[model samples]
Target: MEDNKVDSKKKRLNIVSAIIYIPMFLGMIQFFFDENYRNDGLGWLLLLTFWVIRNIDQAIRDWWDKKQKSVLFDLLLAAVVLVFLIIRGMEYFSS
Candidate 1:
């Protein structure tokens, strides 16, 4: 039962990862052709979105696992992601 639960959780996480990364792969392809970020940067947006989502997910998982030290590390990572997310958001929206 426990093993099944773990497998199911892993499968869900894998699905989430694929959902995030498939577009990232597409974005990378688009990035290589144009290589211009001044006016448009969907790739950068996608990358940032993936980072923040992963950070938050990891933080939540660590908290649930009762791993205090790991959770702190995850929080620190989340802080970094938040800073970048804010900066990129402003740039994306303002332009």
Candidate 2:
């Protein structure tokens, strides 16, 4: 049935998202234990960027499934991520 198809798609999406999250989680653990990442602010910033991007993707998917999407919330998330990327880029270039 169509319902089964939709459920399967959702399950697949969740599986894929979990797979993507694993690397980010491992990276954070590595970042914490690694002295080099501690010394380099850029590394920390890059890790944060990846985390934000992953969350943004999830948010977009969630909004897509809803009948009434909140444009303001999505736009705010985009803006914040943009500002974060800009700051991280500046830090990367400065260093």
Candidate 3:
């Protein structure tokens, strides 16, 4: 019974991650191609929606892993975001 519970939890997390991460990842890519972000609102809406879904999915996974309070994961996630932002900033400056 305990083993089944763990397996089920893992399966659910995988399914949820797929449902959230796939679209969120694509939305992030779309932001780069979107010029509407300059004047229109749809791009911003998409960004906000996808970001929320992505973070929610991460939170769910973290909870399932019993690491909801872990600082290491938060720090690593922050580092990745910081690096991505730095890289994007450099690209913008170069262009």
Task: Please write out the lDDT profile of model 2 over residues 10-76, one tens digit for every residue.
Answer: 8888888788878777766676677775445655765766757665765667665772355456556
Tens digit per residue, CA lDDT, model 3, 9-65: 889878977887788667666775776654223344455555555555576667667
Give the per-residue Cα lDDT of candidate 1 at 48.
Answer: 71
> Candidate 1 lDDT, tens digit per residue, 8-71?
8877987887898787767756774674755246566667766777777787777767799998
Q: Of models 1 and 2, which has the larger TM-score?
A: 2
Each prediction's RMSD to truth: 2.8, 2.8, 7.4
Candidate 1: segments with Cα more than 4 A from true spot: 35-40, 60-66
**Top TM-score: which candidate number?**
2
TM-scores for all candidates: the values are 0.68, 0.69, 0.47
Point out the higher-scoring one by lDDT: 1 or 3. 1
Candidate ranking under TM-score, highest first, comes to 2, 1, 3
Top candidate, metric lDDT: 1
